[model samples]
Target chain A: MADANAETDLKQTPLHDLHVELGARMVPFAGYSMPVQYKAGIMAEHLHTRSKAGLFDVSHMGQAFLIGPDHETTARALEALTPSSFVELGLGRQRYSVLLNEEGGIIDDLMVTRPVSEEDDGKLMLVVNAARKDIDYAHFRDRLPENVSLQVVEDRALIAVQGPEAVAAVAAHAPKAAELAFMSAASMEFDGIDCHIARAGYTGEDGVEMSVPAGAAEAVARALLADDRVQPIGLGARDSLRLEAGLCLYGHDIDETTSPVEGAITFCMQKRRREEGGFPGDERIQAELKNGPGRVRVGLRLDGKAPAREGAEIALPDGPVIGTVTSGGFAPTVGAPIAMGYLPVEYAGTGTALELIVRGRRLPATVADMPFVPNRYYRKPKS
Target chain B: MTTYYSKDHEWISVEGDIATIGITSYAQEQLGDVVYVELPEAGRNLSQGDEAAVVESVKAASEVYAPIDGEVVEANGVLADEPAKVNADPEGGAWFLKMKVGNSGQLSDLMDQAAYKAYVETL
Candidate 1:
């Protein structure tokens, strides 16, 4: 159902030809023609990512650099728009944050990585969701002061090599990448091509994301794929991987009407931001943090193999609807159907019984703890 | 025995009053890697165009419609454990159900093998 013929106006990534050559099933996603899966199929791709390294073409996502006089100036300007402690973010570190509307709802969630060079102190590199990039760019362009500027880097392609073997496999091409600890980044050369590698990924595995010039993207991908442990993965596995990791997908899990507190992303709001309450929607966020959100995001495990897809109603036995599933599917890693959804805080506790109205059938389900598969991020021991 | 295909990619093989039904091979390829299946219960009466079964892949779920009015005779029990057979051989071992035809005339409206093959090319 997903492989509808792409509309003529849909955009294509730099690796479009390469994907087609590899027998990828192309589908229209977020206005771009992307590979949903290759010849190995989604099941095999998902399992391969869990056992080895899987390369993902995330080039459709927006990449940009925020430039200002110094790190303090840029960080302060950004902090005013989002609930994050950017000023305290150390060089080479990456932090996840959400752009919020005045009503305190999420505009989009993004990654902000500080380049690890003294000269690049004033520049903050950002990676925003593909579908929200244009809107996000327009929003930031309208808000930042005259001294600060946003530079959209459309000439670059982003690729993620994820799984347990990702670190060592990537290090084979650029040994400097091995030095990056989790949530960190640095500039490195891949096969003589200048690239930026980050020690982070959306999947629950330890991995590196590389930013390379558009022309060199395919070559970089080939260089990484040449490794025995690496295979080209597609968007199908990407969604399942992130879901099993308990991470939110922008439009599905968190959207403009969903607040961070209710979305279970309160971690993005650090202690300082929570106390000061200066960012957009801070008043309501602070209240929810202290009094507890009216509704909370929780994970669900279905009683059977029938997947409770997005928009399915969650209810008590013969009772009124209490919640709705936001994201759900058969988690290949868990080998069962899993879901994440919003429920009244009362029914959010793990092991709480519930039923999902899937196509008129009242399927039994239970609230469960997330990261259905434990995160396997590699963190270096403190010296 | 004569095989017929519907515009919606369903296929039927009729012998006597009983007709075997399943999705076409093209349909299975589009759905990709079937993970779960929900079949209409045996003995349920279904009208033409009514949903007869549901096939779910990793990304999406599709409803398989009844190509003709019929009374369900049996649903494939094998699919409960081996749904991927739908991908392996959609018109063979992956047949979804069998039914006693209620309207024999409806068979004339469906496409034969040659017609279905040409129809698939346009898709």
Candidate 2:
């Protein structure tokens, strides 16, 4: 992808050649040559994923295992560095967490999963943002005790099959993956290929993310593509899909200077961690949770077709600027322009009227509840 | 009647004192899947190189500048409902507007089809 010869320094995913063969328009992303869109273009691909299933190559993200002598040792050590309830994390269960700096700003958002069986040797698996992977590994290396070590799993490719039909499509090859509940993980064979499948994804859909060995990645991808429901989706639709789902794209919506509470993702910070207050930035995070953050992320619905892209100024009606847009775009699901930005608590209300300076014109907008489209994540019924 | 192209990828077809304006086929291909088009009002006057219209794709919004100074005579209303026409027929049905040519002298600066084809290859 990305012309392959555009820049010799850029890395390529295992599915890179497959994307090019599928007529994907590749672009530079997170230092890798990734597909931005296919021949169907962004709009159709986005709508198709919401209706059926879309397979995305996410191998650029960092995958690693924290190995220790036993479960308690690794879980406790991980909990010490992150604001997550990892100690109570049930076997086979996974929880989303943020790595924070000493001052409480987020270093990165990641997923930590406790292995389902003892054969994994008390390894806690982590999947971090592609751009923040290197920095995160360094951070973990510098802090872990001698007994605990980080094992980077670079010889693997990750793919996400998402949408309403994702479960049925994946269940065809890895039947056990269908039985796993939301936020659960299991090791299974996909068409005889070994893989680690997780019943989770970023698209706000009922989906599974599979991690397969590098050599077998292409075969796995081809098998998935053979299904009519699963088409190769590119990053263009991925951004819009996640935006409609109100999910944050790490570096765009949150960064080193943003707190988990300010980012409106305190739900990821479990209650036990909230009270125990042992992780980095607990002092600042706790204070913010108690006193409320200075600025909070909120959604905006624009009045017209002209989208208020990122970096647009958030202002009151003919008044002074109060915040800046972090992510904004033409949300195909909403059929209008939608934006997410951090605004003062007073202006974060759903009915608050605001203005966005887009393309040198003041566009009228109003604060609205997020997930411009409702989240369709599937949850099993309690017996 | 003769057609001229601008380096910015706009095309103008001149017939007497009236000229029709639209983006070139190459421009439409580069923009890809036009979802919306914003054209100037019929009576508005424009100078050569003025930002006359805006075309929006799924990923970005691009300006369509005036190729020659003129007063807008009419805008293609059909494009408002069917913006994809710009991609399907950039030069004919998707013309953005018709203008009363303000100065014929400005036409000398534009490239003919042969020259534009050569210029595009260099890009």
Candidate 3:
């Protein structure tokens, strides 16, 4: 719900008018007036993306590039800030990493990509959460080495076409983009429009995200929507899809207070980086990697239909409160209520009995393995 | 018998001193899918505008307020198992509760069918 102040203060995306034309219900999100759901509704939209294809306007996310003399300088400068291995990041490849604060808390999780072509040699493209972009930019400007600099791209609109039929839909315009392997990216043209297309997305599905010029965003979106298989999806479906995928949302599941290890996203950190330890809050993160954090984030599947939303107290069966739900809702694909929260490392095991105090009553719950719904991301086959 | 509407999107039907309450079709449409519903127990007394029931959709939870002063006579237990009924037949089998009206005069504060329909347009 957008309050009176929200309506006046929020910004609009490039496709704002198009969304309004499609009968979308706009809501204030991340300082932008974005669509929460279209005429098809959240449930129908979620199922449509799973069974078919859904297009989303992710332009609200921040896009930038780290400019340096070469990849080595840029990657090392970034490596000093994050715990991920970026020096060896293959060209055309992307990796998920988090920005750590001084104390090792996850400031934000971001996608780091190295463009494929020689013309784009010394640059590593970055896409960060909209809410934390300002903070991330400020930190990079303050901490980055003199040789490397951050250039935020403000003239581009990011669009994602996701789900089972996503590739087929996107291939109709950009055939070269469809050929790239998952987690890889390529700069291609869509009917003469130059864009950076990444074979990646937030939904647990095979898809691609196109960074297009803001002026031509509507044209690109309209061309994609012309395909019968693709429908416009809003933030509501996007959140549900990512939740079912066991992906963490920035402000909710992971925030400035939780480390990547405590957030249960250790995949972003490699073995070499862990042992060498040069990033911010390395001491705390390294300690957690070995001893394990006191509280670890885990998935919680409710025993009944009642959805336990964020802020619900999670406790032992008839026991004291142990943690709180950070992200939760009725998972459309799972056809059940699901949630994620932080719990003691001992109680984070799968199938551990748990209780969620939603409203006033304590409902039965259990520690379930994340990715409540299996991800169908495209995996490149071997020769 | 007459149907009255509250600004909170509840529909109330009164025949003599007995009143039946449920969310309107418009409310159901706004709420998308109704996943769960919490209804007040029978014999519970409610004042006008008091929170009587809770309705949860996939994304949010909304409280359904009592339309008028009343004592609960019965709750629709069918919704306990089939919450989708609220989206399918919001003002019918999905009724939240039936109550013995304590003061019928309070009904005047609510809008009639035609007035409520026009009022929703302004929103």
Candidate 4:
């Protein structure tokens, strides 16, 4: 979330003081004073997490719970707003879904987790982008059934421990957490505070996300960082990690103007949801599902080393502008330049050669399969 | 040999007729990861302060300007596969290119080590 107001008057996270004490380079991001990098710098931080573990303070995200008497009523109300099949989601499991507008464009991408039991009054939890939280809450408040209560959890801080050794790093602090499978979350005790631990992350690695109380966040982060395998990574490394994982940043890759189909995220809509068609933007989304979108998001491999940044115009063989790059940079893992952009469906296939016009020079590029680096998401055995 | 720096943080080490150029360590740190380096082609003539190469990181892309009027004598091919070397050794092994000095007088327009240090402080 990018708050124009807070951009000038930056807010501070629970770890802000810690980051400053550690000599981190703080920059304004998503309405907070965030560390862009540390003394090791971005390159080392990028590779460090790929090889070891990195702890990220993502407290800027919004955490909230939806309570209803039963899961059916709560999930149905949420399904009315998002595109995912939340009702059928098993207990302790989570799904990546999008909140859509009436026209089918995304409001934001969020994670919805089912409650651990039917007795729990709060049956659903939502983690949303920080910048859009206020508006998102207002939308929910107006649309949701009175039976389902939306309670914003303001006293919590979110931290992500990501990489191959993340599980071990975090498990050291909360040993019981070692058994939690990917996308499954549970309320547990850590450092004498109740915390919600989810086996999920943005880096496409085996990791766990902890929603700790504000007071315990710093202690949890410090404990994790105390491990030789874990280091505190900043937003700079976080951006590169997600980019390489082929995940989209909220404002850059998917916004209100881009539909789910156009963003190449139609897989988010379950078959049941597709047939039950009561959701917003159903007509446009279902139509695109059948006929394909006019423009689709795809990855690009620049012919040369020159990076084609966001807003760079993409052209076809005849040099007509077809689309613009949404996100582009050098992929440290790939050893070359990589980009993600929307293009006409005809130009969205793997190996569809194209050109990027930057500064009057047309550099050759080609559509490539995404997750520029292969994803490593952990999934439990299917029973 | 004498070294000179541009405000944009590029540094050039000049000998008799050839000059070796690279980005300052501060520049690399600001850029984060140096993932790709687009070096100028050998024999490409460049004027002082002209954009001669491109340097990209995981988060940003920057243009490396020619330190002085010169013709590219050699480009760093090693960077194509090992661009991280720039982060590892910004001054010595990560030099972007070597060029034949075309107008040595342009060197006077750049800052020396002491001046460059003070310039960085102001930033």
Candidate 5:
């Protein structure tokens, strides 16, 4: 039974009432009542996002901006916090990066985007994990130079529409967003309401994530829902889709102790950032970059139908526990159980035989390649 | 023959000394799409309220408790290959196991069809 205080303490998004009206099974997520699954269930919601389009209420995510006098100062200020090269991030483009603590451990993973509008030149927008929002804001408030400021956007809602048919479903209302290249963002009128839409998502699908005004969120969502090709997805499918795409979930796949190198996300750091060593944890990151991390995150494909979850022991095929599963579940797209975990570098190679100790049974598994399902981002044809 | 329900959401239908056990339809609905099921091995002795089988959905795993003391005689191996059957026909073809009752009198401790319905409504 849900505790009374816990239920009362749970926050609701702008679309909470809409979720209930649609017969959504609301569950507490990151201190908010988020939909884990709708009536169609996780399986159907997951499959629909792969074939058609799935609308997700991601408003629980933390949205904020780092403000400065110009783009350089703003980007440089952010570059000090994360390993990624933000200065070179062009207008309309977005880059994924992680916030590192003084020890170089990941504090949180976030997406940084430079808005396309010229009026927004001096500000870099950020979207962080909901659970870490307070930590992130406090960290920024304490660290950012006096010349720069951190402004949290509390009145906006993030709506993500992902899948193969996502673009068509959303483009019917916001035509300019359809023109965006993957990793690009644009300010456009979505259903006649001003929204910041980006052609990027966690699901590894061709889709858009729109930052809409909180009050207009439902109207915009209802407009997109009118499309026959779209379905409202719950957080349950959101997790499975990202797992199949080989994406990491903060506090699970990574934490304050895990470095970006060990987390298998080195690409977020550009060559300049890697060589300059200006970011937090650069000393350890540079060392790991040269010598390789002692342990690395790898994908695991279990043999049987039984799904092994987070904290399951990962063992060598013939003996001994070596690591623990970080994120795992039944991948609806792959039609099999898939998982990701940290393993000793020696045993992290693809095709390496492994075993997952679940329910006291050592189930056979293999060190498989990631993105159990392929990423289908909509990239522009090169000129 | 009589069907009895446990508060843990498992149902056991007793016929003579043999009893068939499975999760209730309400339990299956709460579990969502079942991906896997692990049943007790034949000859495994279970006391009332002991975990007798495991039912796994895409979200997580749940233990189905033995409503009454029994010795597992046979498990429905078909569930291993097609676990979704539990969601499709939870009360019928998807019965978890067949057991020889250890104490038929313990069956009296379980809820009857109508009483079980009322108990579920309270939840």
Candidate 6:
């Protein structure tokens, strides 16, 4: 990646120097100077993360803590905004939820974690997208209960270590981290500093997310990357990695105009939230749940070598435009062109034939199931 | 045989009135992990600097230009399925097209290997 230092003055992450030392091609991403890939390149990094482990410096994301009087008070305050059962959430567990507008469109997707101990009552942690964090925090501040306090933890940096070998790689450095299951989080010690370690990730792989103090972030990232299995990945690989795993990016796949139900993210809303009907756009979501959404997100496998990219028109048998691709790429592991887009419910089934209009040529395509690469979540054992 | 390159990083191997075309190593390095290639059909006449092919990577799409006026005699069908070959051997097996040159004088306008390397360094 070419560096355009003259173009925009962007903020640098704690691992900025480390990335440069590792021969990373730095690029401007979400207002941060981040690595898009190392000398090994994006494809190699994408595949390496699939087979081994990849470390990502996502400290650009915003972190905060919401405190009230008790768990019931905190859960009620959070549930008023997001469509998740924060009350039923076990201590130390995290939930994937969305911030929605009044009309039900997604504002942003965020992670909410409840600390393991009752000692930290009415306190919940939130991690939001870097680009939308300011607006998200302001929105929360305006809507949260008067008794609830919102504190932005700017002194922390978030690091994600993802892939099959992630657990082993991280456990090697922090032994107690091995006991944390998927979506569970706890305050822990690393490199002589107290930090929050969560069993979560975006790549659909088994991984851990460490929220370390800003000053210690560089040391923590270095210690993780010092392992043979861990390599620093950039945004180029990050986009492709998430696409291959069928994860929806906030601005691209699910945006202000797209609802969680239509985006196939209704799973984020628990049954209690669905029936209680209190979160924003509850009517639209309930209607969608009962009758199904008008259009739905689905994956596509192009028939030929042509990659059907975002904004490419998807046409029907008669050559009429039916939908548009939101995310498309050549999956490094799949070894072919894969894409995800929104199509009418009638045309969302697997094997449904379609065509992608690419530069005036009609390339044949078909609907496929999501998570083109199967997810390997480390959930607790079913009772 | 002599090799010359265009500013867009396409290289042409010239021998008599025939030229073989492929992207330079610098071009491939910038594109990263080529997933698909859209080469012009054989028998299609092209002008100098025409947009003759499309190369897609996981991150973005790029256009490959024709370095000289010519008629395509052959297009690399191998790249249709194995585009990574471009990354593995950009100068060797991953050549995009072969053309019958219509104007020999166009070769003087292109850069040689040394000139191309220096030009790339400025980028």
Per prediction, the TM-score for chain B is 0.98, 0.98, 0.98, 0.97, 0.97, 0.97
Q: Write the per-residue lDDT of candidate 2 for residues A115-177, one digit (tens) a residue.
A: 888687578999999999999999999999888999999999999999999989999998998
The DockQ figures for the candidates are 0.54, 0.38, 0.62, 0.45, 0.75, 0.62
Question: Against the true structure, whose DockQ is highest?
Answer: 5
lDDT tens digits by residue: candidate 4, A88-181: 8988888899999999999999988986655674479999998889888998999999899899998889999999899888877687678898
Screening candidate 1 with a backbone cut-off below 3 angstroms (N, C-alpha, C), the clashing residue pairs are none
Task: Give the lDDT of residue A296 in candidate 4.
Answer: 90
RMSD of each: 1.5, 2.3, 1.4, 3.4, 0.9, 1.9
Question: What CAPRI-style quality would you assign to candidate 2?
Answer: acceptable
TM-score, model 2 to reference: 0.93
lDDT score, candidate 3, position B84 = 90
What are the per-residue Cα lDDT tens digits for candidate 1 across B33-69?
8989999998999999999999999888899899999
Candidate 6 residue-wise lDDT, A284-343, digit = tens: 988988899999999999888778889999999667999999999888888778999999
Model no. 3, DockQ = 0.62
Which digits, one per residue and each the tens of the lDDT, describe model 1 over residues A21-116?
989988888999899999898888999999999999999999999999999999988898899999999999999999999989999999999889
lDDT of each: 0.93, 0.90, 0.93, 0.87, 0.94, 0.89
Candidate 5: C-alpha lDDT: 0.94
Better of 1 and 5 by DockQ: 5
Residue A86: error of model 4 in Å? Answer: 2.2
Q: What are the runs in model 5 whose C-alpha is more than 4 Å off?
A: none
**How many Å off is the CA of A121 in candidate 6?**
1.4
TM-score of each: 0.98, 0.93, 0.98, 0.89, 0.99, 0.95
List of chain A TM-scores, every candidate: 0.98, 0.97, 0.98, 0.95, 0.99, 0.96
lDDT of 3 by residue, A127-225 (tens): 999999899999999999999999999999999999999988888888897788999999999988998999989889999999999999999999999
lDDT score at residue A360, model 4, on the 0-100 scale: 76
Please give the TM-score for the first chain of candidate 6.
Answer: 0.96
